[model samples]
Every structure is written in structure tokens, then in C-alpha cells.
Target: MQTPRDFTELSMISKTRWQDEELQYFQHALSQILPYINSEGLTILHEINKEIYTRAEKQDSQYT
Candidate 1:
């Protein structure tokens, strides 16, 4: 029988897996249109890039 903790961990793992799959799908879609984004999409992509850069900096700081 699964304990409550086991169920919670499994739920989190499932959510993470779903998120990773979605991210991959979006990445592949983006790769198809290599340099032809509209203005609004460009803005959104810029925000995403900024967020990724910020998170990478935070992770680097943690390791340093």
C-alpha cells in the first residue's frame, strides 16, 4: 500500500514530467521558425530568455 508521502512525491514527479514534455514540444516548435518571430511573440520570447538567464545566475550563485 502507498503511504501519503509516496502519493505526494509521485504527484510531483508526474507534474514535473508533464512540464518537461511540454517544454520540449515548445522548443521544437520554436526551432522550426528559426528567425521569423512576430513582435508580440518576440517580446514573449525575450521575457522567457530573461527568466532563463536569471534562473541560471541564481543556480550559479548557489554553487559558488
Candidate 2:
């Protein structure tokens, strides 16, 4: 398992990543799915994001 110190030791980003660049990666990550889904469907990704964060927080609390 990676320790908190291990992650803290990572270097800072060399360059600022633009919003479009981040969205491009986000879109590309979903490329395997059908193109029919619209922005409405994308909103649910936020819920999924929240759930993952919540679970991560729970795990972190247990560890800490």
C-alpha cells in the first residue's frame, strides 16, 4: 500500500494543465461508450465522482 509520505514526496506538475485538456482526457476516458449520451447523462458522472470521494474519505478515516 502507498503511504501518505510516498504520495507527499511526488513532484509538482511541470506545467499548468488547461481546463479543455482536462475535459479532453475526461471525454476520452468515456470513448468506449456510445456517442448518443448527452450532457444530461454526463451530470451523473458528478454523482459517481461524489460517491468515490465519499468512499475514499471513509477509507482514509479508517486508516488515520
Candidate 3:
């Protein structure tokens, strides 16, 4: 899957809908799911988010 940033670069209508729908879906899904995630998993996910952005910026960062 394209990193989330790829969706942000789309047209306003698309970005808006993405923020509105897909983001909401992910948020809701995460909400239902995060409680089941251990702290280590949470930390790993945080790192993944950081890595995704870093990769987006320089296009050279390897995702951990």
C-alpha cells in the first residue's frame, strides 16, 4: 500500500474524502483494536508512523 502521505497529495476532493472516510475508518478500527495492543506494539506502530513520514520526505529511509 502507498504510504498515507500519498493520499494527501491528491486533489482536495480526494484528500478531503480520505480524511473524512478512510481516516475515520482507520481511526475507528484502531480504537476498537488498540486496547488489545501491548505497549511494545504501540511503540512499534509509532515508530512505523515516523518511518513512513521519513521515507516520504527523503525517499531513502528504510522503514524499521
TM-score of each: 0.51, 0.42, 0.39
User: When superposed on Cα atoms, how far off is each prediction in RMSD?
Assistant: 10.3, 13.5, 11.3
Quote the positional error of residue 2 for candidate 1 in Å. 23
Measured with C-alpha atoms, the lDDT of residue 44 in candidate 1 is 45
- Candidate 2 Cα lDDT to native: 0.42
Weakest lDDT window of 10 consecutive positions for candidate 2: 2-11
Model 2 alpha-carbon miss at residue 48, Å: 0.6
- Give the Cα error of residue 39 in candidate 3, in Å: 0.7
Best-to-worst order by lDDT is 1, 3, 2
Prediction-by-prediction clash tally: 0, 0, 0
For residue 13, what is the lDDT in candidate 3? 43
Residues 1-64, candidate 2: write the lDDT tens digits.
Answer: 2222221231132112223344333344445463766785465345434545565688799998
Worst 10 residues of 3 by lDDT: 7-16
Segments of candidate 2 deviating more than 4 angstroms = 1-31, 34-36
Superposed Cα deviation of residue 4, candidate 2 (Å): 32
**Candidate 3 residue-wise lDDT, 7-52, digit = tens:** 2353234222343334444444445678798886566445445544
Error of 2 at 40 (Å): 1.5
